[model samples]
Target: MSEESGSLNTTAAVGEKINAISDGSQIISAGRAISALVSEYVQESYCYRWLTKEPDPDVIVIDLRETYAFGPFITLLDQLVPHIEDAWQHSRVGAAAERVFKRLVEDVFAPLSETRGYELAAAMLAPPEPPERRNATVDDSESTEDELS
Candidate 1:
């Protein structure tokens, strides 16, 4: 096999070994599910390969319901929004700001606040709805700006 293929196989084998050693029964928590969803959202888009693979409406509902199985992921989310917004805002400022933002997210926001961490992560996964448009096309020849105003 090629070197890269061999390395991937080795990694997979190691991961399997680790899983085998750990207890097979894992507690699926809302925070964990939300975190995973957020990760997938950030990694891809709303139209992720996993979503396409499992397009059944029932399955999607089941997955969403799993979020509530453990508890409301809301309280945790409420704590996370401000820190994340701050970090994101910082990144937009400059290179130094970006570094500071990354540090803040990694050290302060993520570590210090678990509930907020999951909340912020979940928000990132939310998909945008389609914008509403009028059925009729606007006429460029007419100026109705004053009338509309």
Candidate 2:
């Protein structure tokens, strides 16, 4: 069969139970499927590392940058956002999925982003702080305290 017809056959072959579902149910089910996919994807790839809250920012960014995750994640999120918004405006199950999606963004994703670790990757890689700032608490002025008194 041609590619288009092949895809139609595959879709139609989901079994009679799914074929009998209403359009609203299909949309809702799709939303839940998407939500589960995203959740599993993030947890397996990103969230587990993130939730560690590693002490060193360099370590965190280095871990995250592995396999070039950041760029693709941004792309996926951008594409998903519009679909999620449309789902929210469409059906009750979609609305519930939207809530789950929003919580994922706000509670988990936002804090990870606000850490600003990605932006600091370079600074973390750079050489240590200059000598002058090392003992900043020490008074290094030309005049001593005795002279000032």
Candidate 3:
């Protein structure tokens, strides 16, 4: 098979794995999942170059955030957060999972934050804000303006 087809096959496999994890059909720990995702998906994408580039961190983060790969990874990370704790509690996989997660945080994310800035790393690692909270803030401001008038 051609290289492109192989890549596509790999991508599809990764996607299935991610979906399985999301649906709880697969019992892999978050760290393993994350490692697979980064190596198999993110590293092969356009963002990898910018992620490893020596230029400004914020610029790299910003550029990467706009790419197609960024959002899904962010979403996946958010989903994986709960699993990390659960995996850590299991004896069989706990130690290994923790080690992998820690390395991803330290080796991958920490360096990104240290070299680039916190924005991209934070965006990748942070849980997304709920829509209701955002809407409430906007509504509060609107109400305050009415009271002032």
lDDT of each: 0.68, 0.76, 0.81
Between candidates 1 and 2, name the one with more favorable lDDT.
Answer: 2
Give lDDT tens digits, candidate 3, residues 1-149: 69999999999999999887677744456667888887888777888877887877665336554569787788788799889877668766887877899989988877777765577666788988899999999999999999999
Q: What tens-digit string does per-residue lDDT give for candidate 2 at 1-149? A: 59999888877777655756644596888988999998888778866777866677555435443458686787788899999888769989987988999999999987776676854875688899777776663555434665788
Which window of 10 residues has the lowest lDDT sum in candidate 3?
Answer: 57-66
Best by TM-score: 3
Model 3 residue runs over 4 Å out of place are: 1-112
Ten contiguous residues with the weakest lDDT in model 2: 58-67
Better of 2 and 3 by TM-score: 3
lDDT of 1: 0.68
Strongest candidate by lDDT: 3
Which parts of model 2 are misplaced by more than 4 Å? 1-88, 121-149
Local error of candidate 1 at residue 25 (angstroms): 53
Off by over 4 Å in 1: 1-60, 63-71, 87-149
